[model samples]
Target: MTANNATPPAPPVPSDAVGEGLKAAFRFHPAGVAIITATTDRGPSGLTASSVSSVAIDPAAIMFSVTRATGSAGAILDADSFIVHLIDGEHAELAQNFAVSGAERFTEAQGWTMRETGEPYLPAARVALRCQTLHTVTVGSSVVVIAQVLEVIEGTRGEPVVYLDRAFHSVATA
Candidate 1:
């Protein structure tokens, strides 16, 4: 077959590819870690996310995805707004706590507080952005949320937490 008319080889079937292989492929890429938090009737809820990204600067918007049907989904979906926190190396325990299937994410001992709208916020985050959900699209097992940053809260500055090679590392300031 001529190059222009040649049919491309069929894409590899996903089922034929091992899940671990896909995961391992992405393991080489490093991503900044953050925690997404919201408050619902049940209580404060959160999850650790490495998929957070700034979608736009003029509008000051950000986007992140969360697994559908998860505990934090309802809180984030029902609320008009939520908080995204940039975690540092020292907050690995906090990240792991929120990463679990069912864990007490926000305890009184952690000193979490609520905004005027009642959404919970973590005070110790390296940086916090209060965002208003603008749009959402469901893709596969995840819901991608795009939000406009309504407020920015600066916190303790230092090394940032990053996830890579299935482990967490601190970005060096120097």
Candidate 2:
């Protein structure tokens, strides 16, 4: 059979199917959970993200994506800076509080304090990074935010929270 005369092309994958497939593929890949917090005129807001990654070392930059519809997205996009709190196994509840919409994130109950630019930093996090927003790019359904690290606070040493297989897991030290 000739090139064009061979078999017919396969049908395009459905968007929902593609989304489900992507989710399944990522479920096995463990990722560190973090809460990206920013100050809004209304108050403090934040969201949990497993996509945070270090981008550069010289300037100490990190990147993470946030859905446009998230309550904290507006504040994060508009603010000059924000805080990235690396959640640990002990603080998974804190991560869940921010993961969902309309949760009281920065109240006294959560035990947080304001950072340099008014961003909330969790005192119980394994590591807290204060970063200044450097660049933001809209990709697909999320905005990719790049920030420069302004300061870092080392919290209680422990196993960092890892999300895998639709659940949170922490590895024990040997």
Candidate 3:
């Protein structure tokens, strides 16, 4: 290894095959919806994310990926802190607002607050997690962030907001 700690070269791949494999290889299970928000000097920003998951419970960590081009990513890079709000069915409008990229989101939200670290939180979320950036890895156009959960707020009882088959679902049995 070099003193500079540069990564070793990777072997060459055949044309287009690896790309196609990547497109079809990974089929993930259904996941719940969450909003990852960060506070930056410019302002608070966030995205409607369906990728939130617990990586470990013992160490209290979770992982989510954000497109490098996502507005929230730019804020996260600056603030180095964030929060993940697990949405409930009551937040359908909230999810829609967050999913809409660009422009102001927090301006219209009623129960949102910016934490000291510049992360955004919602009083209505089923679960709100304050996070410290533990690790970040680049994968193509996205950055995978694994955060150490610092603070956890458990909400009053409610149904979970879920996403499956490209549709929104609630955990409350009908």
Q: List the candidate 2 regions with Cα displacement exceeding 4 Å.
A: 1-16
37-76 per-residue lDDT for model 1 (tens digits): 8887787778888999999988999998888878777688
TM-score of each: 0.84, 0.85, 0.78
Task: Give candidate 2's error at residue 104 in angstroms.
Answer: 3.5
Tens digits of per-residue lDDT, candidate 2, 1-174, equal 234746788769568889888888998999999988888787887888999999999899999988898668888888777889888888888888888766666777778888756888887788999888888888677898889999988988667678988789877666
Q: Which candidate leads the pack in lDDT?
A: 2
Model 1: lDDT of residue 161: 77
- Work out how many backbone clashes candidate 1 has: 0
- Model 1 segments more than 4 A misplaced: 1-13, 16-20
Question: In terms of TM-score, which candidate is stronger, 1 or 3?
Answer: 1
lDDT of each: 0.82, 0.84, 0.76
Ranking by lDDT: 2, 1, 3
When summed lDDT is taken over every stretch of 10 residues in candidate 1, the lowest stretch is 1-10
